[model samples]
Target: MAVYTELKPEAFARVSEAYGLGPVQEVVTIPEGSINTNHRIRTPEGRLFLRHTTVRSAEDLRFEAALLTHLTESHFPSPTLLLTKQGRPFLELEGGRVSLFKWLAGEELRRPQLTPDHLERLGLELGKMHRITQSFGGSRDNPYSAGQVRSWLAGLRRHKDDEVATVAEELEEHLERAEGQRGQGLEPRGVIHADLFMDNVKWLADRVGAFFDFEMACKDSYGLDVAITLNAWCFDNGAYLPELCRTFIRGYQDARPLAAVERENLFGHALFGAVRYSASRIRDFHLSPLPPEQLTRKDFRTYLARARALDALGPAGFLALLGL
Candidate 1:
């Protein structure tokens, strides 16, 4: 769905030789997600994922490769970054960066099929991943920072279009409230998967096969990742499933217990997560130049509704859902 460039056999052959991956037998394009081209490469040596992206800088791609390597070193379930003969994780080709990675075997779980058991596992895996990533020496600043949100809102205001104005108004209200409460409690900082939405996770049987797509990996408050996961995974039919959220927290606590600060700030962080997704979705769907078909636009309604609902629930109600 995100293939923006045509791939040729000759290019694959060059990559194979450069990486010593053996002769490339065939290449199949895998249509999933928006942004970046993904292809499944078959070789006599082994199966691998060949991903190409022009939108990100070479530095960003290299940072992602390093993050993936770090995660693998921590005994986490993530794809190993395949190195070139020159000992680099990516190849510069045709105005984009292409990287080969060991293909992970699993199916992506959708919301309808998700259960508390699944959330428990997701929580446990995320907890372990967070704990492991604490020692990662590399760091990337969050691309979706509060400042970025404010700038996006400013862009919307300049347009003067009715829809853009309405979205900007609503988003500003949420952002104002969420930003105002940032210091109610102290949140511990660490490496986090800033975009750990459901589609990014893969499952094999009952275990997490791998957490792919480290494109948005960055350093932030650890609670932000927890909040983002709960926002994405523990919701159904335009509402947050309180019991499911509780179960997820239970699983996370079993691995790494939440600090008092985390529990105190959970609701605010969740609201921040909701606002983040909603604002981005609006920018992508309404304001961005990319066509609807070329890029996937998640419905902004879900996150907006969740943000409003969480506002009504208040801190006590939100904490109570997690059995605090």
Candidate 2:
């Protein structure tokens, strides 16, 4: 329902012709995301997932295209971007840029339905992705680093709402502590899916179908990706699920073993992940100007609770919780 810019009939016709997809038969809006507009469109040829984004620059899109191409070459289970008749990865339209992907098959599982088996499979896939991308020559810096999140918190602190400002002030403290403790430049670096939440993955029966949503992929510490994914998958009912965390990390290490440095630095990375998402949910969902139906408002407080839990655990307690 986050269709900020709706496509017209003429626009669909143009896309169909440009991609040689034949006449468009059905167009269904995808109601999940917050930033970009997505649709499941069917033409005479087949069904395709169409994505339109005004926020991403051409350079960003090309980086994603290259990353996807590399993943495809590696035989990774990911969505394949279909080329236009001109062999371009994407098309420029009036309202925004559009990219069509051959619809990937699978279902996105909700939190309650996810099992330790699913986390294990997901972790293995993530590890494989990181391992595969180590040879990828393309590079982009992490956009949601500590410094960037601190800047976001600074802006949020000035908001008129007292609750938002208070939370932002608290988050700044957490960010400071996490950055101070983390050995910043010592971990193994690679291209990471910086936002690998559960919603970004798909499930086919008991196995992983695909890992989608590469918009936030960037070059960063490999440990950071593990921490971010751990935060996304292992937390439930206001607490971290220890068994799930253990299974996930074990699966990840099964593919590419974590270095001593990576293991030692996971605590700081996890804390930073909590702070980053909490602040982002505040900025993107809690304070969004979009109407209720257009965007789903995920409570920032859930991530705030995570930040608090991590702070209470400290580094040693966190490691113990993960059985690291």
Candidate 3:
């Protein structure tokens, strides 16, 4: 819904020619995400996905493009990056950087349609991605890590806004507890799609066909990645689905075995994952200076709700469901 930069037909046509995607027939803005501008462009050749954003540095853009390319080459089901005529992965347009991807075919599965089998397949894909990216040469530090969340909190405190101040104080306490628990155990590190929510994946024939949106990809604990998936995929109607959790962990372990430490502290990481996204949702949705129309604010309270649900199911209780 946020189209920061409007792309005229001529402008889009030029990009199409530059990328050898044939003459553009139509341009349609995708109104799903809040972060960047996305468009589905139709050309005589086929459909192409053009994403533009001024928020990312050229370095970050290059990093993302290269990561997607790597994923494709590694037999991962990700979008195919279209190269420019000069063979570049992206183009530096006047307004923002534009990257082209082949349109992936499939529909995103909604929560009501999700089953334990679906959760297991999602876990299986995540495990395969973790295994491939373990040796990936590229790395980006997580911008939404606990340290960054604290920094965002500090910025909010300086604002003198009461609501902002309240959120910061609450997040401060949660961040402190989450960070303390994070140091209790160390897990194997890899390039993780730090934000692997259901919406970011597409399903074909009731199975995962592609995993997209690597903008948050970074070098992090594989365990934390698993924990993030657990928080995102296992909860339903303010409750944790224990059978789904067990199926997910089993599927993840089917590809990459979890260490003893990962099993022992998995629930702690899930709590921190909850903290991470909740803090981010607050900062991005409420505190940031984005316009109300442009802002696609998510309910940060749901993540807090998820954290409470997880707390009810202690580490032993969570792992017991995982049959660990």
Candidate 4:
């Protein structure tokens, strides 16, 4: 239902021919993502995921293609971009760019279905990805940095809705406090999968089969990545699950031991993560013009709750909560 760009039959045929995929047997619209238009296309060869996005530029796509190639060479479990007949990573069609990837084999585990083992495996995989990306030569700044989030919040604070405006003011305070307490920024830096929500991971039984959706991948603090991931995975029903948090961090540390600096600065990073997502949800989801069928709206208040909880815990209390 998140198909922002609708492709015609001729478009599909052209894409299949260009990619050397045989006649298309089936085309089903994928309704999961919020940014790009995705479809599951079945050809005589096999099933592939077709992603079309109007918002991304050619340079961005190239960066992603290069990153995916590096990941493939490193033997990381991720989607490999299929090249066109001309050796390009994607094709231009229907006023947007389209990229094809062989469908990965696995199902995304829902929140309730996730266990400590699942979080541990996910953490290990994330840690492995961060380690692998250290050798990657590509560089791209995080598009959703603190400054960008602050700009979004500034606009939200002037909204016509009093509740939204008030919430924006509250988030501004969190952002300011987090920036002040984040320290001298001496933590390790590297490329990270900025958005590692549960849906980004696919599982084959208890083990992770793949980590996809590298569109938001960019260079940033590794500790920030850990904080964002913890926010995504460890929180449920307005609270952070202590057991899941402990297991996730333990699994990550097993792969690449966090420096003492990382441990000390995690609280600020976590608070920033909560503030960033809360602002984004309000701007991208709550205020989106797209109808319900075209976009999935996530509650901004959920992340606001996370910010409040983090603030209540304070820095020392947070480290204690994570048993760091």
Best by lDDT: 4
29-85: candidate 1 lDDT, tens digit per residue? 876645677899989878899988888887888788888878887789987888999
Per-residue C-alpha lDDT of model 3 across residues 136-188, encoded as one tens digit per residue: 79878877777787787787666677876776677667667666666565678
Check candidate 4 and list the clashing pairs.
Answer: none
Indicate the TM-score of model 4: 0.98
User: Would you give me the overall lDDT of model 1?
Assistant: 0.83
lDDT value for candidate 2?
Answer: 0.90
Model 4 over residues 221-322: C-alpha lDDT tens digits?
999999999999999998899989989998998898899888888999999999999998888788888899888779999999999999999999888888
C-alpha TM-score for every candidate: 0.93, 0.98, 0.92, 0.98
RMSD of each: 1.9, 1.1, 2.0, 1.1
How many residue pairs in model 3 have overlapping backbones? Answer: 1
Residue 176 lDDT in model 2?
A: 84
Candidate 3 C-alpha RMSD relative to the actual structure: 2.0
User: Using alpha carbons, what is the TM-score of model 2?
Assistant: 0.98
lDDT tens digits, residue span 1-324, model 2: 676787898998999999999999999999877688898999987889999998888888899999999999999998899889999988999767999998989999998898889888888999999999999999998888888999999999999999999999999998887886678557889899899898888889999999999989999999999999999999988899988999999889889998888888898898899999999999888998999888877989988988899999998999898878
